[model samples]
Target chain A: MTVTAKIDVKNQDISESIRKLLEDILKTEIIQAILVSQHLPMKKMVMPTLVTDPDHLDGIDPLAPAFPVNAATIAARLTRKPIGEKIAAVLRPCEIRAFIELVKLNQAKRGNIILISVDCPGAFQNKDYLKFAGQNPKEATLRFYKKVMDGNAVEVEGVELATACKACEYPVSENADIQIGLYGMKTDESILVKAQTEAGDHILKQINLSATNEPAARQTAINSLITKRSSFRDEMFLKTTETTNSLEKISSFFASCVNCYNCRVACPVCYCKECVFVTDAFNHDSFQYISWAKKKGIIKMPTDTLFYHLTRLTHMSTACVGCGQCSNACPNDIPIMELFRTIAHVTQKAFDYQAGKSIEQKPPLSIFCKDEFQEVVGIND
Target chain B: MSEFEPTIVAFFCNWCTFTAADLAGTSRLSYPPNIKIIRVMCTGMVDPQYIIKAFLEGADGVLVSGCHPGDCHYINGNYKARRRIKLLKEILPQFGFDSKRLRLTWIGASDGIRLAEIMRTLVSQIKELGPSQSKLSMVI
Candidate 1:
């Protein structure tokens, strides 16, 4: 049976309530540590930190509107090998999805890890978040979530959420072992907590919290958010398709790229240990460069820009979780997410598959049926 | 303008299609010379990057011919190749590559005439499609 409970809020401090919850979880004998986003004392930036002591939960800020990096990579690292202790990870919805993808790829194991998620109100880009969190990041986090939960305007000081977040259809993660709710609840009084798995139920049973029924408004609010986001996503797809429908247009779309490869690095599902772009294969001889230039007469220097992007799409589009980290990592402010999400939509649809949707579904290229996809084979047929 | 002779890059599986090409040669079958054959151990080994590079480097068409289903020497290499092709067919066309430019076929070793016939038809089909847009324009 599913266990639904609430964390009582005092003094209107949601983060504190969450911190207390984490501290309680950490205090449990079953959980050795907790992985969550926290503010580093040295800097205002929030990053994923592993906390073993209950006292360290003071810095926990999973509600912080700062997504510096997808913690899935961190989760993968922690759970890649058995550490002999269980770690509870507090993650955003997209991070949980990406972690699920990593698990499917055999890059991570889920044996000793419990995934916890919150109803994501969305996040700002890195630059915008820095501006949003001027002096006190903790206060800024509270302000952002309060406004969102109150059904007020999301844009504060002319800055809004990231495009990926705005277009995100999944504000709630159904796959998480435990979920914290804020979309349609009286946060000033209490917050919702639900256990989705047996492990989550076991943990919830240890904590003394009053059971409650989910409010009807929660599903309605979630539906409205999804409707708004899906419309935005379709519009984005239309615009991206118009801009990159041809090779010449695609070249112009990525014209500002310097081949820094930050997008691939930022991608959680791009699991290659050694990308061919950085290998000796791409280290062409001087004569080869000259010959290539001589043939085209005016070839773009730092060549293979288009080649690199197309190759990446073919290699990783099926696994792309539309996390928007690629656009966040680009120095040139390229809308890399728009193009990737657009193409990924088509590629995933062609296989009737969705990336990060389920653990049972194998990756498109990883497994294939003998008689399937016959439409793709042969010329006359 | 003179009649267009499209340059086709054919990646044939060594166990099947490559042997068919060899059989065509021995049988004195007259196929179009526009095709440049590169024998791979299996069609599954023909990475998507190979097809993308050929298109970018000015090949008008690419063909990945392997054994028929269940005839794969390495079990299900051709099946894997099919999914990759289906994926590329969805992506490359979004960037203006005609779905016709990329193909996957199953030609058995003994079907020399069938292999020769498909090549003639492929070359003609590509001729109808004209030169690849990437060939006429600069790609970097």
Candidate 2:
């Protein structure tokens, strides 16, 4: 079991307290910028923010229920080539998992960044968040925290949390240097912080937080959250699988796709610089159209829509983290996340691999294992 | 009406299908003149996007002919191609294109008559289906 320590919350605001903590880190020569969640000044929306100045930490709002984007891509960009100084990045559990996948892909380096993850209480989708925040964002945030901390379901404008968040199995970050504990705790007085690594232990030691045992109440809270999430995920799997089990059904399910390719751009892990779809390779001449129409009678406009998606599935299904950003980014509102998650569930299971689970495990496709996929490869016989 | 001559794009594997196509010409066997053959090293090397591109480029239909299963010069290239093209056929109809427009067949260097037969059938099928209207070029 992991040990946790408590940080007493004085009468100070949560954002201000977090800011002070970051400021202290900046004072140390070893630390560079502190990547945190902050509310934008114009909109009361909270998103991942990178703070270089101690003074700027005042805007940090990790508690706000707005996650416009995952911070893994940001971490990937930061550590791509390296910037001399070490930085501390606060990420959600999913983001940490995503960073793990990115690192495995050689898109990110782990040498410089300190990963701090908090127990995710789940978050609302973008539009639902705006509706819930209506007129008074601060009050909404406080209410949200209260409801979640009190073990009540947090709803935004009568809508439940995003399907992805509701079904997420990992609420606590498995790969964090430092972890912020929120579930099963007294929110008004204090919250727990646990260090999972040597680096984390060093940071916690410097901060001098009072040590505490893992509270029984905290375990109960975590169990309840995980139970709820698992049930939701199972239901989601059943619902999606029932909708399309065969190739014909699957094809029909995506029949409305207009080939907009929004899902591709929305996927953070889809790091291809030049997509095959957009290249000159897909550019067809006019006469070819007439010839095909003359033969086939009618060909769908925006040809190769199915091919484009299938190709992407083959390429990225094994790495899919089920962020639901693909569905969120679609203008046509296609249920892309459902299709991807369903396929990923099957593909990943076949390889006994879950994407973004661990940095140590390499992507199955990148390695050649003679004994792997024996059933599918028909090599077992 | 003008004689219906379907414009087909044939992606022929260099070692087998491409050679078979050459054999057809050298053997003085007559076949449909609709096909415009492009040589590739292996069927596995053909990206599904290329087939889609051929359709978009005004080709009435596409024929991807490679060595028979387990007979590929590259060992398992044809098998991989089969899996990819099979998946492509399953999923392509969702985007509104007739998945039938794309055909995958295994043709050996000795099977010049089989290659000619496949082309003749493809050309006739395409002639019945008419030209593809989904080509983005037609809109502008």
Candidate 3:
């Protein structure tokens, strides 16, 4: 029922094929610009760039195993109020999911943009990526894709993919208007690009790729990848629950956090206009710290580190998409993502809701059903 | 360790729970004098941070009493409060505090006796759990 197509892998390179496809999209008069990850001229780092000229798309590489930031908020800012022409964005599964959550939070709009997503091969943390991509970023991306597609080892040398990626069960982009399929295909040959929405169908028509059928192998690849990730996710949840199961452990677990609030900054769905942490309310008087210390005789220098994280967890776990960027952004590497995700997994399941699953489904707290979570309220028949 | 009287922080919604506490005072209802009440405009106005700060400030337990689900002065404040407290309950235990330390209940403006009864029960429930190890053991 859905329109699917294939883009021939040029010169036996998946990255080249994707680049050429993006170029073709930019060439179209209908699309004004494209937002993609490209290698910076000076640094080896790859970040999201809005490319207007098709010629500049030469360095575009969305397949790289590097996620420096969650671009959902960026997309939100860009699309919050349209700037006349349409823009095509190439995002990962997590990024798309985060953007969807933003849209639900009323931070982003769904109109006047094209969402192109790919089967995520997962990513490495920023530091790990720099070490892995020593000189050639392009080749690093290709090698990473080839290994993942060939069913070879996921890591190179000693560095592996980030834990968030490994724990992620949704590898396929279910929310994108256009899904660029990599899994379940012979990537040395060609990768399938399927249109998942009416907007996707319209854009594919403009590109003029030959229509195809959904392959059986793609579903198999998706299932196996998810199964592997789900087991790891469950293991992570159990381990996190056990370790941080008590106040002492929880205090020590987040003790490294200097109350920097980097996790809040990096969170895609934490879309509050003004956070309570930054407000004057947290500005305790000089006497307050002394008073606390006088009572305890010994106290942590920077108070409320534990309190801050717990507050974030309460405010955010419901909307947490489990992208793991929080941990990635940590200077102390506090593993904030693992704790939040572990708790989020339980909270989301308790409400029978999945964050960013669809725009139609209301957030648990936003709309209340009289019958739902009745057990929580202890309502006897 | 003589009697182990639990220090409880109770958040009372102004329109209902706060009034219930006032009525209890006027009616001379006998409940454990264990709680310190802070009144907010509505239950929805009670941030989870206030509860976390209470436990951190060495309160052995927290009681969040609001208007009945449909009886909120602001229409749906209690509903929102219910959802947040229910979620907070799930997460608090994993952080080393017993989830039972936090209690959420609907007490109407006229239910002064009911409010006292619930307060009595909460104090006893926390008394049995003993003073929380995190808050008590830290205080010198």
Q: Report lDDT (CA) for all predictions.
A: 0.91, 0.74, 0.84
Local accuracy of candidate 3 as per-residue lDDT tens digits, B19-105: 999999999988998998989999898888898888877889888888887788999887887788888877887777887888888
Q: Best to worst by DockQ, what's the order? A: 1, 3, 2
Per-residue lDDT for A88-124 in model 2, tens only?
A: 8988888888888889999899877889887887788
**Per-model TM values vs. the true structure:** 0.98, 0.76, 0.96
TM-score (0 to 1) of chain B for each candidate: 0.98, 0.91, 0.94
How would you class the docking of model 2?
A: incorrect
**Candidate 3 positional error at B33, Å:** 1.1
**What are the clash counts of all predictions, listed in order?**
0, 20, 4
Tell me the lDDT of candidate 1.
0.91
- The TM-scores, chain A only, for the candidates as listed are 0.98, 0.92, 0.96
The digit string of per-residue lDDT tens for model 1 on B1-140 reads: 79988999999999999999999999999999999999999998989999999999889999999999999999989999999899899999999999999999999999999999999999999999999988767886
Tell how far residue A5 is off in model 3, in angstroms: 1.0
Q: Candidate 1, what DockQ?
A: 0.87
Clashes of 2: 20
